[model samples]
Target: MSSLYLLHKPYRMLSQFTDSEGRATLADVIDVPGVYAAGRLDYDSEGLLLLSDDGALIHRIAHPRHKQPKTYWVQLEGQMDESALKALRSGINLKDGPTRPAKARLMTPPALAPREPAIDPKRHPSTCWLELTISEGRNRQVRRMTAHVGFPTLRLIRASIGAWQLGDLQPGEWRRETLHAPRPAKSAKRSGKPTATRPRRHS
Candidate 1:
């Protein structure tokens, strides 16, 4: 048997279980021993982060060779246009390297909780919303990409990874489940049985 946990990692929480500094880490929320985050989400970023006690599962989720698609709901600092979207979809060059092509589209913001430090409406900066799916994970890749296209990301919330979704889990919440293999990856969330939700966890 395997232990898999899907956590809605809150903003400002470190992806690792421990930190030299007293800042919040996964230890603050997760009590499941031996299960580690399969991939990382930046402290400034929020949303679904998968953890598992199984090493093979971790590799499958985190390794670039696996090419698991991660979907994000992004709010940007300027109006979005077709040209910018085309650059995102065609793979723009970044400091790290030229990125692989990705899926990007204009979107209405989804119902999400306000960040601890909400974007001030007083500034009244024009903004746009985009939903992007990319198979490659790089350090702050989405944020950098948006900025390269001239619409700096104001907020980044990863909504899904492959078939697993954040669903209705609020910040610092998690669910445990067993995933069976061999299903169609693209359609799993839409067609699979309802995922069992667990109770909220507190630090």
Candidate 2:
């Protein structure tokens, strides 16, 4: 069994435990000794971050090859429309490479807490939020993707990673859960009737 922690990382905090200049990091808030961040969230972004003591588990969850979906609520600079959504779903070319197709849709106003220091209102006059779900976790991919489509991201909040959701976990808070839990058996029927009327005779 491995130890897994879900941390709601705060803005401006470094992803790693150690920082040369004594910057705020997981070490500052989380006292766990052995656990380490499975993936990284940039200092400027805030949201769900997973940490684990198991290296293999970390790779499986964070590595792009696994194609684990990560969903983010992004506040962009202008009102987004169907054309923008289509472009996002199609793909966006970045400096490193072209991003893979993603699930992009306009975000219905999230119920999450407001970010401290708030977004710059002057830079973003008519802003609209969008929900972007991507499997590839490139460096600053969400920010870059929105920028590529001409709507610079005003703010970004990761809503979920894999099966875990941020929920009401405030910034700098964390929760622990098992990495692998046994799946519950599915019900035999959906409409309260067995699919097979009776057991067939062996023939």
Candidate 3:
């Protein structure tokens, strides 16, 4: 059986174990040997990051083809309008290409622990929070989406991925669980081909 770990990756920390630049890395927080991060979380973004020793599980979670949904709590630099939210929900044409439609909505500021070297209120006086959920994992996609809609993201926090949530895990804290094999896909009636399905999502 494989081992799975849910970690609250802190801001300004690299996802990998080593950093030649001497910046903080996962080794500072996670001491487990042989386990590797399934997907990357930006050094500046803080939130839930999944790590595991199971190569197959890592592939399923990290591969864009799997389309595992990831939700973020975004702090935008300006007031959010319905048009912006609608555009986000509809999809935005980015430099990489048009993104998939995402679940976007205005949310009240969440009560989150202040990050070290928090966003200076002087630089960004007015801001609003947004809850954005997307199935694709692109490099800085959340930040780009908000920027394209005229609202720059001042801060971003990934709230959940698929069925796993950050919950009450504090910075640098991690929880471990045993992995289980996924259910086999059911065969289609006409084609006799297996239909793809993922684990149930978090409510």
Candidate 4:
């Protein structure tokens, strides 16, 4: 049977199941075997991450060719502007190549918990938030794009990937579901507490 796990990863946690540095890992919480993460979230990022035992589904979720859009609530270091939004909505030229057009909108912050060690206010920089959805999965693409447009990102929380969402899961919480199994309408969410919060993009 194939398995899927939706985990709300907290910040500064590794996405791998194990680490030689003795840092907190997925094995610290996920007791199950034979399942691997479909994608990886960055160590510095926080939000929904998916793991699965189904290889094909993992490929579909992680492959850029599939064009599964990723959504994030981003806190910018300074104010947002029309020019920046236009550039992002169109495409941002990065070192590698130009990104595809995205669904970009400036938004008020979402209701989320504070980071364990809060962002420093000493810099006295104004901050704005944006909800960005992109189909292309690149390394630090969202942050790089925002910074490319002259607004450095202060915080980034991924809200959902394709059809999956963070929903009501809190930090370190996880829910498991098996697609092949039959179920009633309500029996979907499973619970776990894992250290990793960053789900990876297609790599």
Return the lDDT, model 3, position 110: 81
Q: Candidate 3, residues 66-174: lDDT per residue as tens digits?
A: 8889999999998999999999999999999999999999998987879899999999999999999999988999999999999999989999999888887778888
Model 2 per-residue lDDT at 104:
92
Candidate 2 residue lDDT tens string, 26-72: 88777778888888999989999988889988988988788889999
Best candidate (score: TM-score) = 1
The RMSD (Cα, Å) of candidate 2 is 11.2
lDDT (Cα) of model 3: 0.87
- Please list the residue runs of candidate 4 whose C-alpha ends up more than 4 Å from where it truly belongs after superposition: 181-203
Model 1 lDDT, residue 180, Cα: 59
In order of appearance, the predictions have TM-scores of 0.90, 0.85, 0.88, 0.85
Write down the worst ten-residue block by lDDT for model 1: 188-197
Q: Residue 13 error for model 3, in Å?
A: 0.5
Superposition error at 132 for model 1 (Å): 0.6
Provide backbone clash counts, one per model.
0, 0, 0, 7
Q: Supply the TM-score for candidate 1.
A: 0.90
- Report the C-alpha displacement of residue 165, candidate 4, in angstroms: 0.3
Candidate 3 wrong stretches, greater than 4 Å: 182-203
RMSD of each: 4.1, 11.2, 6.4, 7.1
